[model samples]
Target: MSRRPDPTRRSEQSRQAIVSAAVDLCVEIGYAATTIEAIAARAGVGKQTIYRWWPSKAAVLLEHMTRVRETQIGFPDTGDLRVDLLAQTSAVQGLFASDTGAVWRGLLIAALSDDVAADGVRTLLQAAVVEAKGRLATAQKTGELRADVDLDMVVEIIYGPLYHAWLLTGRPLPEAYMEEVLSSVFDGLRP
Candidate 1:
């Protein structure tokens, strides 16, 4: 008899499909409109399959964001702190430029309106901030960043404008804007 396929690999594939469906549906129809039934239909999986793995649609979207961070926005440790930071920041900016960014913003807005989504957003942001801090710590260790720089402050400086332009105002996230923001934050303009 033929051996059965690996259950772990099969489960992983199903999970990935669900996440992809959630991201796509959330982007196309806003988070508030994207229901578990729709995601399951889009993913070609049963509702029970999704509910069996995730507690809610928000949880699936949260896991989807985590997957996006892992696969799309991996931090690069180039040994040159400035280049590393620029690359990392640019990755974030690029994410905002992609379809996934639309879904992320939609979920964020929906999260603000709903407590469950808000909790998921909180967990997602906290984890992302921790990752950002870890990368900044590498810069500090390499002596590329000023010893006095507060890592949290640096994170805010880097993320603040991007969030404002992309999330708050819904403006186009141009690469030039990212470069200018990074230069302003890193180099500062003073006569």
Candidate 2:
């Protein structure tokens, strides 16, 4: 007889599949168009499977964002704060330059108009900020970042222009743009 499968592992795998499917669906079809039914279908699970785990499509999207941050955005400590900061920021910039980035931006804009989506977006951004601060803390300890520099403020300085250019101004985000932002940021933060 075949061995019995582990229920806990099976459940975890299903959950992951659901989240991954949700992310892919949200990226391909805008978040507004990605339904729980579609995510369940893509994951090869039933709609009840998803409904049992998440309250709504927004919840699934929020969970997917958390997973992306955990898996895709690994921050490195290269001893050189500038290199580390650049790498970290560049990783984020690359994400924004990707197809999923366009979807994420659209979702964010839609969130602004939908209260449920807005709450999910706010929670996702808060989690991202926390992760970013943890990475910045490494630089602070290395004495590369000024002790007085506010991590939150620095994060805004690094990301604000990119968002403005991509979302508000419809400008292209060339690598040179990121390099310039890094140069200006490091110049102001260097002790």
List the candidates' TM-scores in order. Answer: 0.84, 0.79
lDDT of 1 by residue, 104-164 (tens): 8877887867776788788878877898888878777766677678888888888899898
TM-score of 2: 0.79
Task: Give the Cα lDDT of each candidate.
Answer: 0.81, 0.79
lDDT per residue as tens, model 2, 1-191: 89999999998999999988877887787777888889999999999999898887777767766666778876677787667767877888788887658557766877877776788788778877887788778777877788889999988988788788878877777887777888886878876
Q: After superposition, how far is residue 73 of candidate 1 from its true place, in Å?
A: 1.3
Error of 1 at 82 (Å): 2.0
lDDT of 1 at 82: 60
Which residue pairs does candidate 2 place in steric collision? none
Clashing pairs in 1: none
At residue 179, what lDDT does model 1 achieve? Answer: 74
Residue 11 local lDDT, model 2: 89
State the number of backbone clashes in model 1. Answer: 0
